[model samples]
Target: MIRILAFVLTLGMLAACSAPPSSTGDEVQRLASEIRSLGPDIDPVEAERAARIAYSYSAQLAQEYEITDPPLVHNAKVNKGLRPRGLCWHWAEDIERRLDQEGFETLEMHRAIANADNPFRIDHSTAIISRKGETMRDGIVLDPWRYGGVLYWSPLTEDTKYEWVPRDAVLEKRRLDQHGALLPYVSG
Candidate 1:
């Protein structure tokens, strides 16, 4: 009886551990919807242009492809002729520019060098935008071009380190930020 009970318990634990977290497709769809809703609230002309650009690139990436990173996917579909990894920074810069043109106060930040002792450098950028006070938390969305996903704000102080926000954490942060109406967390 003891052996059987232990086996059953172990099996249950394994099943739980192996289960996948939230689907990326559903999360992306939610973020897309949120962006669309916020579009009308922005300045009309700029909003239209920005929305068109974001939507167009997003759609292109959704087409059949093995790539998953949003920025990379966008670049690949739009510029198929270019070598892989050639347009990472270019796409980020383009997104930053469009967001700025849309009248949303924007900021671009770059990751610091790995270490003085090491020759390697880290290349990543994040965008921050200002929105109505009521929409503060949801204001900052990290569209990691190399990683095709959106991350929302959390209680992430400068000290909290993470390569990427877990999908559940991203969704929770989105809700909390939207609830509190606090500005997006920005790191120097």
Candidate 2:
């Protein structure tokens, strides 16, 4: 009975962590529409291309990262040197690097860290895309690590689960905090 129960649980987890559905073109179109809504100056062609790349590259990374486990499980594997890479920061970094290659004329990419100020939770890193003149707060979050490589995106303000801060600002505050100066945690 115990063996059967264990097997059932394992199967359930695997099912829950399976690769995202096959109809990714729908996702691409949805993301492109959202990107174009950022501002009037954003080029529709650039938005479409960026959306396509974001989804496709995330799928590519999932295969490269050998992501068969849930996000936290993969993260533990990465920390234990059992896996090469699948962490949130890895996704953010790789996506940002790939997107940067496009040299988008009307769009810009930014990196953000969430839960940096909360000692009880692990920090989450993600890539954000916004109009060239805007900041990360005004961008759309491109997060692939949350569901083991399935792409999840939302307008910054609409991502209710995370309160994101600019990555540089978070790092700088941590630096300052390390210098015997304590900074209060501010939730955005």
Could you say which candidate leads in lDDT?
A: 2
Can you write out model 2's per-residue Cα lDDT over 1-188, one digit (the tens) per residue?
99978866865675476454455558999999999999999999999999999999999999999998888767777998999999999999999999999999999999999999799789999999999989999999999998778899999999998999999999998887787556567799
Scored by CA lDDT, what does every candidate get?
Answer: 0.41, 0.91
For model 2 the local lDDT of residue 47 reads 100
> What is the Å distance of residue 40 in model 1 from its true position?
16
In angstroms, how far off is 6's CA in candidate 1? 42
- Residue pairs in clash, model 1: 69-148, 70-148
Steric clash count of candidate 1: 2
Instruction: Identify the candidate with maximal TM-score.
Output: 2
Error of 2 at 178 (Å): 2.0
TM-score, prediction 1: 0.34
